[model samples]
Each structure stands twice: as C-alpha cells, then as structure tokens.
Target chain A: MSTATTHTSAVVHPEYDRLALNRFGLWLFFFSESLIFLILLLTRFYLFGTSRPEELNQTLGLAITVILLLSSFTAYRAETAIAHDDRPQFLRNLLATILLGTLFLLGVVLVEWPEAPRLGIVPQEGFGIAFFSMTGMHAFHVLSGVLLLLMVYLNGRRGAYSSDSYWGVEASIKYWHFVDVVWVFFYPALYLL
Target chain B: MEAKKAAKLRLGWIVIGILAVLTAVEFWVAIAINSALLYLAVLALAKAALIVQYFMHVNQLWHKEGHE
Candidate 1:
C-alpha cells in the first residue's frame, strides 16, 4: 500500500527530521575525523619501527596507558545510560568519564612525558620525534573530548536529551570512544613497544 | 526493562575485566619475553579490538544502525 511505501521512505530519508539530521551529520564528521587519525598513525609507523623493545619496558607509561584504557569503560557506561533514558545516571557517568579522561591526559603530560626527556630522550631524537608526535596528537584528541563532554553536560542541564532524542550526547560519546581507540594504539607504540 | 539494563551493565563490566587482563598480560610480556616488544604489540592490538567492539559498541552500531 502507499502507507507502507511512505513508511519505508521515511526511514530511508534521514534528512526529514531533526534527530536524523543530527545523527547523519555526526557520523559523517566522525568518519572524516577517523581518516585523519588513520593517516597520522600510518605516518607514525613510517617514522618509527613498528616495535621497539626498550620503550616497552617503561613502567610509568604503562600505568598511564591503563588509566586511559579504563576510562573507555566509563565512557561506555555513560553512553549506555543515555541510550536507556536514565538521565541522572547518564550525567553521573558522563562526569566520571570526563574526569577520568582528564586524569589520563594529566598523567601523560606531568608524569610520563617529563620522564621521557629525563631519560635523555629529546623530541629531536629519531624515535623520540615519532613517539611524542603520535602520542601528542592523541592527547589533543582527549582534550577535545573533554571539551565536548562539557558541552554535553551543559546541554543536558538544559534538558536537551531524552530516550527519543539524544543525538548530541550520542555524537559526543562516539567521538570520545574514537579518542579512546586512538590511545589504544598509541599506548602500545609509545609504552609497550 | 530495568532488569535488562542491569544485565547490559554487567556485560559492560565483564568487557572491562577482559581489557584489564589483557593490559596486564601486555605488561607481563614486556617484562618477561626476550622478544617482549613484538608480543606486547600483538596483545595491545587484541585489547584495542575488545575495547572498540564491546566498549565502543562499534560492532553493534554497525550492524543495527545505518550510521551514527
């Protein structure tokens, strides 16, 4: 019937609604951002060996890596809460996830990075350049995720998201997870290998 | 519905446990193996896959949702 055809068309035509517009735009932006990070990762391996033994033995770097890894779980919890329409739980988990991400970044800058130069490793050093460059780029992503989380929190305070409409939170969570994915690679390259 | 949500939460925690164990294994290999770096890289990749697929729900999203 014409009704059935119309229903199918509605599902396919995402631009017909605000929620669909937000979702479509976010995914498109995310895909492009992913390509940029992929290129950076390729450049990293091109400049440094895929595996480096000495760097793998570092303790401080490994610890910070664990922190970053754990934060991903918290971010997931926040997203899950939002998906299920638990506003208070979503807000709590979102704040916790952001705090954890900020700590991960702080650990990288204050602890792991300071120790790098002390180990006689300068950015000008061959592997050192690739190391700092790749990890530094990932840190920048984390900072952006933190800022995005703050925006989500502000919007949430204004009652912007609900079970039926939470594209903003969903998009922010997607980007945060991408930052986590980048660190998953950077951790091993810079600390484990 | 609440019970289903709780179950999903439990599943999420289980995934977190797997990630933690993999991270520990990475640290161990880096310390124990002579070719530690190579092993560490492999383990790290495994852990990354787990986090992305489960924590990020990339697999679920890709299969069910068209985008976003």
Candidate 2:
C-alpha cells in the first residue's frame, strides 16, 4: 500500500486584518467629519457669494496656509519613518510637525483673530460669520490633531511602534492630513474667493 | 525594502514641490485674475488629490491588508 501526503501552509496574521479594519473605521469618521466642513463651506458661499472682505489679512492667511501645508509634509515623513522602522527620523519629524501645527494655531488665534476685527471683520457681519465659523471649526481640529501627535511622540519615545505594527501612528497622521485637506479648501474659500 | 522606502521618501519631496508651486500660482491667480473661482476650485481639488493619494495613501484602503 502507498500513501500520499498533502501539505498546506497557512500563516495567519490577524493583525493585518485588524489594521485594515481599523483604517476603514477611521476613514468613515473622516467622511462624517467632512460633511460638517462641507456644510460650512456651502454656507460661506450661500451667505456671501464670491465676495470676500478686503480687510481679510491675505498675507497672514497665506502664511498660515503655508505653515499648515508644511506640517502635513512633516507628518507624512513621520508616518513613513515609523513604517520603515526609523525611530529617530519618526520622532524628529513628529516634533517638527507638532511645532508647525502650533505655529499655525498661533497664526490664526493671535494674529488672524485680532487682525480680523481690526480689519473690520466682525462676528456679526455676513463675511465675518462665515470666516469665523469656518476658520474656527478648522482651528479646533488642528488643536486636537496637535494633541494626538503629542501622544504619538511620547509613545514613540517608549518604543510603542515598529515596522510590523504602528496603527496609532498611522491613525494620528491620517487625521493630521485630513486637517490639512480641510485647510486646502478653507484657505481659498475664506481668503482668495 | 530599503529601496522602496527611499522611493517613498523621494515621492514625498516631489509632491511637496508641486504643492508649493501650485500654492504660488494660486496666489498669483487670486491677485491677477478677477473671475478666479473656477481656477481656484480646480487648483484646490488638485492639491487635495495629491495629499489624499500620496500623503494619506488612500489607495491602501483598497489594497489587501498585508500589501499596504
């Protein structure tokens, strides 16, 4: 009598599936958040049409936009570094991103907010209502994003993530990028248009 | 693996360069052109696509779990 053997190799990595699911859930959250921003965007045009205030600080607006964009770049690098197991690069980039984010908030809150009223953009007027609401909502997101990055940075210092697993880092960076995307639309809507 | 990481790093710089140029052009258009809504909207969409695709890796959402 002869016997035959059939062998199958199945190496199950549950974390991979778990990570994918986690990412999908995060994206859904972003989609819902997007609806809020979209409604605010539509309100801007609905109330004020294409006309923007000449008093709007175009220079400061552009400066903060640049700062926010730079932060996104650093955040991207930080995520990529963690994915590649470059812990030092990841931490450094994370810090850079955090600094840029803080700068952006300062620009909006200290410079832009005070300058807006001086430039004649009050909370009561049509343009003022849209401008404050739009920028205010966005600034809140940036503040939360900065806090999340701080958490990730502290976790990184303790070696919480590696090439095989870094969901926390990924999730935080994705949120940061979403904030930048909002500003991408908001900058032009509030300043340029 | 190293090569792939290097490629990703390079891609990030290139995307940033394009974004900077687009932002400059956006400023110029806003100043030089009176009716710039259409142009600005297109530029904004393009910028968002770059961030979503390259920076955020939205394609990874569709890729198999291990692949991303």
Candidate 3:
C-alpha cells in the first residue's frame, strides 16, 4: 500500500500536464507575436512623428473600438458560462463574439479603406503606408480570431466542453481577448494620434 | 457554486461598461480635448489591462492545475 501510494503521488493526470503545457505554449506564441506589433508601432512613430491625418475619421475609429470591446465582453461571457457548465449560454455568447469581431474587420477593411479614398486621402509618402500596414495587420489578427471563435463555437455546440474540462473554451476566449487588447492600443495609435 | 458564477458573470458586464466609458473618453481626448500623446498612450494601456485581466483571464495563467 505504501509503494502504491508513492507511485500514485509521483504522477499526475496527463490532462493536467497537457493543459498547463498548452497554456505555456500559447503564451509563448503570444509573446513572439507581440514583437510583430511592436515593430508596427515603432514604424508608425518613426514615420508619423506625433501627427496623423485629421481626415482619418475619428468617429468611425471610436465605433470600431466599441464593437471590438463588446466582442471581448461576449467572449468573457462565453468562457464564464462554460466554466459553470452552461453550454447554451456559452454557444450563444461565442457566436455573439464572432459576429462582433467580423463587423470590426469589415469596419476596418471594407468601410474604412474604401472610404479613405473618397475623403481625398492619399498615402502621401510613408504616412498612409504605415497606417494601412498597422491597421491591416491588426485586421488580420481579428479575422483569424473570428475564424477560431467559429471553430470553438462549433465544437462547443457538439458538447465538447464542460465545467470540468473547458480548456478549449478558455484558450479560445483568451485569444479573443488578446486580440481586443491589441486593438485597444492600435485604435488610439492609428486614429487618435 | 452556481451563485458565485452568476455573480462573476454580472461582473463581466460591469467591466465592459467601464471599457465603454473609457473608450468614449479616449474619443473625447483624442479630438476635442487634444490631450498629449502620452495621455492617450496611458489610456490605451489601461484599456488593455482591463481586457487582459477580466476578459483574457491572465490571472489564471497558473490556475490550470485546478481547472483540469
């Protein structure tokens, strides 16, 4: 009995190790991706010097900020619901997050860009290039996040998560919120300053 | 247990409300007030912190043991 207990205590369930390992790996990936955004910010400041285009629609920027933040809240709700074993609420909130995220991408790519041309806006040296590059990169992240959220939502609808094993929901929501956090910085940087 | 979760969910709404108000303030400061770039940067960092903490579950970075 003593030897058996020792053996049992020496090892943990693989699920625990797997979850911890996954979290570590995901965060490592985030850290590396942060470098790319950092370069974008550096490039923006290097090029613009504290000045941005006044014609760059602050109103629409604010609107995009609001929608993306709303999606973060929805993502939070989805994770929380799954933590409590509420599958239906989890599914609904995840879908809401995906929808808001998609709208944010559209607001940037379709609405913001095409509208820029009509505003008599021109790249004007490196200004427009840097601005588009920064926002475009962020838009890419948003698009990827929306796709991931859809996968999570679909898996969740099939009852893949539970109160005890909801790491899938947690990881996806973390990614969603990370994307929102990036926009919190990017919105002000691109549109405000 | 259920009640605790319900309470947490309520807190989620409150966090988003704070985020909304902060973004509005960012809009005002950006154009109307014309605050310094440093101030805007600070506001952006605050917003990021709120999302990462409450929404991203950064606090749970080491909580996977209990989760699993």
Candidate 4:
C-alpha cells in the first residue's frame, strides 16, 4: 500500500501543476493586453504613415530602450536568484529593476513630454495623441510592473519563497518581460520609423 | 543539479548580450537602411522570441506525463 501511494505521488507534482495554471492565466492577460497595444501600433502607422515627427530625439529613445532592456535583464536575474534560493541577490536585482524602470518612466513623463515640440509631438494633431497615448500606456504598464516587483520584493524579504516554490517571482517577471517586448516595438514606431 | 542551475544563470547573460547586439543592429538599420521596414519587423520578431522563449520560459509551458 505504501509503495503504491509513493509511486503515484512521485509521478505527480501538484504544486507545479497549480503554478502552471497561474502561468496560464497570466498569459491570457498578456494576450488581452496585446490587443490593446496592437490597436495603438496600428494607429501609429495609420496616423503618421512611415514618417515620424522630425523633432523626435533618437538618442533619448535609444537610451530609454537600453534602460528598459537592462531592467528586463535584472528582472531575469532576480527571478533566477530566487529560483536558487538566493534571497539577497534576488532583493538586489529587484531593487535595480525598480530603479531602472522608474528612470524609464521619468524620462517619458518629465523630459520627453516637456520637449514635445522638439520630439515632433503636436498636441493639436493625431500625431501628438497617438504618440503620447502609446508611450503613456507603456509607462503605465511599467509603473504597475514596478509596483508588482515591490510587492514581490517585500514578500521575498520575509522569506516567502524558496527554490521549490517561487511562483510570485515567476509571475512578476513574465509581465515585466512583456512590457519590455512592447517597448521593443514602440521605440521604433515613435522615435525612428 | 547545481551545475545545470549555474548554466541556466549564465544563459541569462548570454541572452542579454544577444539582445544588446540586436538592438544595436536595429539602430543601425533604422538610420542606415531606412527603407527596410520588413527587416526591422523580422528583427523585432526575433528579439521577441528570444525573450519569450528564454526569459518568459514558454518552453516550460507544456508537459505530457510528468505533472511538473
């Protein structure tokens, strides 16, 4: 009897199965979010054609892209650290991600917005509306992502996760990467192409 | 197990390096090959796959017999 139960249990990992369900739900959320971004992207092409405002800063656009990409890397590092039960490394990387993400947002809200004329964002036209709306939505996602990371970091600080169970970390990271992926498209649409 | 985990961590850095190089290429294409929208689109898809397949762990999504 004991052997039978042990054999059955050995072939099954219910915790992981549950985690997979959560992952599924998150992916569904991402799919829906993609629809929203798709419309924004389409609007970019429809409104601006192949040309962007001549005033846009290619350098700042690239800088923000690099920052967001580096933040994605740090988020990956944090996830990997937590997977190995390295709480300190996880915390450090999480902080770095938050800082980098916030910097990206500030670059948009503070510097980028103020330099609208130079960036070719005319508030009175379709160009301004589409450009700001696109970046603003992405910035909002980044803000939510930063909040999510902070929540995960707080829980992680209390030793809420371990090598065997770190679904919170996993969930946060997938979403963060999605935000980065969105920017990968948005950067070119708004600044360069 | 430990060795495999270490390799996985190193893979993260490898993926990041690839992404950086691709981004540089994107910038070059944007400035130099201004008419190459299709090329940019393809590069964007490739960059997306790298992140999704690796960082997002999409490969871990399915399993047949094993519950884990």
Candidate 5:
C-alpha cells in the first residue's frame, strides 16, 4: 500500500502541476493589473497621436526594449532547464535574465528619461505625466520581478527545488515573463509609436 | 515522462517564435503605415495572449480535472 501510494502521489503531485496552479493565480492578478494599464494606454493614445512619437526618445528606448524581450527568452530557457533538472543551464539562463532586466531599467532611468526636459516636457506636462506614470509603473513591475528572480536563484542554490518540486522557481519565471510581455507593448507605445 | 516534458518545452519555443514574428510584423506595419499607435495596442494584446497560453500554461490549468 505504501508503494502504491508513492507511485500515485508521484504521478499526481508533479511539480509542474503545482507550478501551473500558482501561475494561474498570478496570471489572474496580472490580468487585473493589465486592465488598468490598458485603460491608461488608451487615454495616452487619445491624448497624443502620431505626433507624440516624434517627441519620444527612440534609440535608447528601442535598445532596452530588445533587451527585455531577449530576457524573456532567457527566463523561458531557464524554466525549461529547471524542469529537466539541468542545474548549470538553469543558473546560467537565470543570471542572464537578471542582468538583462537590470540593464533595461538602467537604460530607462539614465538615458531615455533625461531628454524629457530637453524636449520641453516636464513630468508636470500632461503628456509627459501620463507617459512617465505608465512606463514608470511598468518599470516598477520589472524591478519587482528582478527581486523575485534573485530570491529564486538563492533558493535554487540551496537546493530548495528539484525536477519534482520547483513550483517556486516556475512561478517566478511566469511573473518575470509577464513583466517582459508588458514592456514589449509599453516600449513601442511610449517610444517608437 | 521526460519526453513529454521536453515536448512541452518545444511547443513553448514554437510559440515564442510566432510571437517574435508577430512583433516584427507589427513593427513593420508601424513603419510602413506610420501608425504605431493602433498597431502597438493590437500587438500588445496578441503578445499577452501568447504568454498566457504558452508560458503560463493557462490552457492546461483550465483543463485540469479537479481543484484541490
């Protein structure tokens, strides 16, 4: 009976299943958050049209957007490696993701944002205020994702996960990827668009 | 079991590729038509759907048999 129970539990308690459930809850939360952003995005578009694109700082912005998108791929690879118990590959991918996310944030703060004053658009300006608020909120999400990834990395180093029990890491990856998804749109809308 | 897991990962990469292509197309349309505003909004929703279905495995979760 004990052996039978072990076999059944092994099948029923696959780590991926638990990870999926956690991610489901997280996605619901994200969906709600996205609705708010969506409304904000629409408002921004209504207020500023194609002419606003000319006002954006595009070069550095597009570069950082590419970085964030690539980071999502790295995070995806890391989760896949973790699912297969490939520790070395998982760590490498996760580290790459962290670096890319950080670079993305830095690009925003140091490079793209400084031009607001030069463009005669202070944060107090209507368009400037909306643009910064929306993208700034998205950046905050990215920062939170970075912190989560750090925790996942530390826990992974401690062997807190395995091929059979990695719900935490999986959930972290999901959240990180969601942040990436949000930025993909935010970048083009706020900068290139 | 391992093979099934590997297949899932492959499926994920395929979805990612499709997303990349869609994004490229959106970028192209934005450039050609000079209307990044509307195109960006639509592309954002597509990208969100891809992440939700492929990366987050929302479809699998919804199909799950029971709730614990």
Candidate 6:
C-alpha cells in the first residue's frame, strides 16, 4: 500500500502542469504589454503635465469609463458561469460584454474623436495629440477585445467549454479585465488628471 | 458547487460596486479639488487592485487549485 501510494503521488498530471504554465505565460505577456502602455503614459505626462484642454468632453469620458467597467463585470460573470458549466449564462454574459465593449469603442471613435477636433483639440498638436494616441491605442485594444470575446461567444454557443475545461473562457476574461485595468489608469490620466 | 459559483458571482458584483463608487468619488475629486493629482492616483490604484485581485483572479497564478 505504501509503494502504491507513492507511485500514485509521483504520477504526473500533464494537464495541471500545462494549466499552470499557460497562466504564467499569459502573465508574462501582460507584463510585456504593460511596458508599452507605461511608455505612452510617461510620454503624456512629459508633454502635457496634467493640463487638459477645456474643450475635452468630461461627461463622455466618464460614460465610456463606466461602460468599460461594466463590461469587465460581465466578462467575469461569463468566466464564472462557464467554470460552473452554466452554458446559457456564459453565453449571455459574453454577449453582454461584447456589446458593451463595442459601445465603448463607438463612444471613443464616433463621438469623442469628432468632438475633440471641433472643440479645438485637434490631433496634430497640444493635448489633442496625447488624447488621440492614448484613446486611439486603448480603442484599438477594445476593438480587439470585442473581437476576441466574439470568437469565444461563438465557440461557446457550439458547446466548447465545461466545468472541467474552461481555460479559453478564463484567459479571454483575464485579457478583458486587463484591458479594463488599463482604462482604470488611462481614464484619470487623460480626463481627470 | 453551483452555490459556490453563485457566491463567487456575487463577489464580483460587490467588487464592481466598490469600483463604481471609487470612480464616482474620483470624478468628484477631479472636479472639486484643485491639486487632485495625488488623490486621483490613489483612487486609480485602488480600482486597479480591485480588478486585478477580484476580477482577474491573479491569485490563481500561484495556487494549484480550481477556479474560484
């Protein structure tokens, strides 16, 4: 019995090891990606020194920030639902997240972009440059995040994940939250600070 | 198991609630205060921590456990 127990304990679970490794790899990727955003943030502070143009839309800024935060909540719900094998809730929350993310993108591209230039914060100079680049880069991530969530939603509809297997959902949701975390910093940097 | 997962979902709701409140206060401070840089920065970091810990489940990276 002792020998049998030792053998059982020594047996390697490749799936568990792979899961741990994947988590580590994703976090490393986040660290690297963070460097890029950090540089952009530093550049903004260097040039603008916390001075924003009077024409910037503070209301719309808060609106989009709220939307992004709400999407992160939905994304978390989706991941949790899938982990518990609740497919319907998973799909529902994923769709919600996707819609909110798309709405955030539109708020930036359609409303904020045009309003900025019309209000004299053009992208060519002054606060406008930092505003566009920061929001532009963040908007690009939101676009990609929406696309990623879309793919996950589609796959989920086809019965792709279960309680025992939900790495895809978890990873995508983590990325979604990471995007939200970035905005948590970016919002104040651009509008509030 | 389902109950546990539901509890986790509820925790998410709670965290989001805190985050919303912090954001609202951050907005108010930005509008009300003149030199609000330090206050805004602290609020931002608090929001980010709530996200990374509760929403992102950064603790999972270290533990050999199932999803919480």
Best by the DockQ measure:
6
Candidate 4's C-alpha lDDT?
0.86
**Who wins the lDDT comparison?**
2
> How does candidate 3 score on lDDT?
0.83
Query: Which of the two candidates, 1 or 4, achieves a greater lDDT against the reference?
Result: 4
Stretches of candidate 6 exceeding 4 Å from the true structure? A1-11
**Over the stretch A64-163, how does candidate 1's per-residue lDDT look in tens digits?**
6777767777777877787788888888888887888889889877776786777666678766777677778888888999999989988887778876
Question: Local error of candidate 1 at A34, Å?
Answer: 4.0
A105-124 per-residue lDDT for model 3 (tens digits): 99988999888767765556
Which of candidates 1 and 2 reaches a greater lDDT? 2
Assign candidate 1 its CAPRI class. acceptable
Worst 10 residues of 6 chain B by lDDT: B59-68
DockQ versus reference, model 3: 0.73
Q: What is the TM-score of each candidate against the true structure?
A: 0.84, 0.94, 0.92, 0.91, 0.83, 0.95
Q: Which parts of model 5 have CA positions greater than 4 angstroms off?
A: A1-21, A49-53, B1-13, B36-38, B65-68
lDDT of 6 at A58: 92
- List, residue by residue over A31-88, the lDDT tens digit for candidate 6: 9988988888999999989888766789999999999999999999988888888899
> How far does residue A29 in candidate 5 sit from its true spot (Å)?
1.7
Per-prediction fnat: 0.48, 0.57, 0.80, 0.40, 0.35, 0.77
Arranged by lDDT with the best first, the candidates are 2, 6, 4, 3, 5, 1
Q: What is the DockQ of each candidate?
A: 0.47, 0.65, 0.73, 0.49, 0.33, 0.74
Residue A154 C-alpha lDDT in model 3 = 86
RMSD of each: 3.4, 3.6, 2.2, 3.1, 4.6, 2.2
The residue-by-residue lDDT of candidate 1 on B1-68, one tens digit each, is: 78867987998899888888887887677557665656766776787678667765555434545222
Which residue pairs collide in model 4, if any?
none
lDDT of 4 by residue, B9-37 (tens): 89999999999999999889988986867
Better of 1 and 5 by DockQ: 1
Model 1 DockQ reads: 0.47
